[model samples]
Target: MSLIEARQADPKRLIAGATGEWEIIIGMEVHAQISSRSKLFSGAATDFGAEPNDNVSLIDAAMPGMLPAINAECVRQAVRTGLGLRAKINLTSVFDRKNYFYPDLPQGYQISQFRQPVVGEGKILVSVGPDNKGRFEEVEIGIERLHLEQDAGKSLHDQHPTMSFVDLNRAGVALMEIVSRPDLRSSEEAKAYLTKLRMIVRYLGTCDGNMDEGSMRADVNVSVRRVGEPFGTRCEIKNVNSIRFVGQAIDYEARRHIAILEDGGTIAQETRLFDAAKGETRSMRSKEEAHDYRYFPDPDLLPLKFDQEFVDKLAADLPELPDEKKKRFIEALGLSAYDASILVSEKAVADYFEALVAAQPDVEKDGKAAANWVINDLLGALNRSALPIEKSPIKPEQLSEIIRLIKTGVISGKIAKDVFEIIWQEGGDPQKIVAQRGLEQVTDNAAIEKAVENIMRANPDKVEQAKTKPGLAGWFVGQVMKATGDKVNPQTVNIVIKQKLNLED
Candidate 1:
């Protein structure tokens, strides 16, 4: 089901107020910085952190007679991203000068796309539900267009009390402005859409999708209207950096609009800023119409045109995206949908999981035992240490060895965790650690029976209770495992304890 359908299925999704039920319409204009070594029109370095204005070139500074040159790599990345989104690619697209004056933009006019964009219509599928974690329902959001544009420089306001500092390092950097249709109905859907978008761009290597680093950001257009009424005028919320902030901003803005209309006040179409500290949006300026920018084709650059073969080659070389990988994990590997989704959320995690499984050829027959370990133990360890999967101390081969030990019954699951920690902290082979520590599971029937008998004799009262309540058999099993120092296989301990207690089915 699409997000709209899912929301319609849930009656509680409708917004309620004194006036009536209202529906929120949301659209997004996401700016993703192209991952290239140099600026779009100049050879200036595109490194994230540099001395202020150190990476600027003549073209970036808008020097006299300086002309803009197209970055072929940026164009290619944009086309790849468009294809990944399943969007239309306009082989021929023109660049126009967006007339806007700001201190950060040394060039009086920002060169952007107006009438023609490199990539045309596209759609992205987002998963939506409560907390975005229930049954996965696909929501197809329409992409209006994806256009290539230059980002303006930063104006550092805190540097000086009297004057602001202009940093041209980011000026003329290539950005893909991906505009979406107003199909979102709630804050959860908007968050899910942004998350899916970020995952796709990261998987494609088009953009880092690092909102904290300003590599990607969103301009949210939000408005509210009565159910079955015409769309209301939207107010643009500019430059929300984080996904959490996006959801918070939408909630606050929708409520603000609803309150205005309920109070007999008209909603103003204007630009707003989300103040993360205050958790609300404040008016920046009136929203501008297309004519306000006075957009026209730039005389310096010509229209971009490419052949079908070029696009075909790009499509051929595209990496397997998240959705495809998730599907394969579910079907071929027999993984649960929740587990597959978690593994494929990040490329690094997915690659690590694939490598781990590849190292253990019997992973498929084990019903994804390796996946459970990676998700529960390895990821838990990494998260506790505040480290990324890339920096994991345990390698895939090492993890595979650990799984092999468990599958072969060389060590119990409880003992394997100790081995994992020893290998993670002390850095030794898992098998060697198990051997050196004598952590092998005790499978001897005689030894296990002796342990179970000892436990029953010591806990006569508990044994009597076990006779009455058969579920208390687990308590006797735990005592056996503890007596054996957790080195015995839990299954063997359970069988022996059940037989000794005469509780065997």
Candidate 2:
């Protein structure tokens, strides 16, 4: 069963029109840099950081007679990503020239796909919101097209005090421009869609999906119309770099459109810029049509065709996607839906979780405890440091060792946290740390009884109070555990406390 179906159903319907029960329409254009060694039409390096114009080639600079040659590896990666998304791959696809004049465009026109795209018509299932008793809401968003294109160079606007510089390191790089249909209605839906898309692309290894590095960016299109009325004029919010900003842009634009209609004004179609600092979208330029760019097929490149066997080969080698891995976590590993979803959201995180479980002695029996420890303890540490799983100081084996210590009563939960901090910062074997620090749990009956006896003798007034009010026994128990530096098992303390105070057996 689908995640939403397996759990209780939520309100899937959109907000009744904001303006007299109006409906909101939304779409997204995501540009993800292709993972390749070189530029699309040139042998120049596709590295992100280099001196200005260091990676530019003769063709990339748009020399008068320089000819363009297609990169086969780029095409293969694009097709691989398309197949991973369960998209329709067009056996025959063509490239067209989109004419636009800008300083960043070394060439007067950009080579892109217009009439025929590489892939079309796919869907992705995205989980929204925080974990609730191991449950979350899942929504299926539609993919309209995934096309191949060349990225323009960067224009450094604020590098110096006076004139701006241009960087061609990113020029002519391969990009997979994935466009989504206007099936989204709310900002939350938009955020979830972008997040899930990033996860899928990262797992496929087609793109790094680093928004901070500008390797991935999104353009949000929003419009609002009265209930049962035709679609309203939409505005495109361009080049939003982060997922949080995408939600803010949509919300701001939607409310702006609604207020305009309410004031008896017309909503004009245009392109706008998202001012992240102010959390608003301001108009950039009037909307343009396809004829405005004067698009035409590039004569330098011939029509491209792919063999059925080739597409099938890439499909066979496709890694397990987020949705597939999530299902396996729930069905095979017996993890809750929420835990499975969090673990599978990133490739590294999921791999780390699997490694930890495999290193345990009783994985099948104690998998739930292992999952909780890794998710709550290790992940919490990595998050505090602002580091990814790959950069964590604690390895999977070390984490498993700590969990085993707790399981066998060699250490209590409170002491384990302290040991974890030592291991995390000082870099020593957990066994050695436990041995040297003498942080072992006091599970022996004689040792625990001696400590509890001192507490009962010193606090007779409290002991007398416990006979009548059993809850008061908790105070003496805390004193004893604190005296032992939290090395005593909490369950054992409760049993000894009841026995000493003459409460329940």
Go through the candidates in order and give the C-alpha RMSD of each one to the true structure.
2.5, 3.8
Best by TM-score: 1
Candidate 1, TM-score vs. the true structure? 0.96
lDDT of each: 0.89, 0.85
lDDT of 2 by residue, 130-170 (tens): 64555577777778888888999989989899998888788
For model 1, the stretches where C-alpha displacement exceeds 4 angstroms are 1-12, 129-133, 363-367
Q: Candidate 1 residues 446-490, lDDT tens each?
A: 988888888888999998998889899888888888888898888
Q: Clashing pairs in model 1?
A: none
Give candidate 2 regions above 4 Å deviation.
1-19, 131-134, 159-164, 363-365, 501-505
Error of 2 at 472 (Å): 3.9
Clashing pairs in 2: 17-21, 17-22
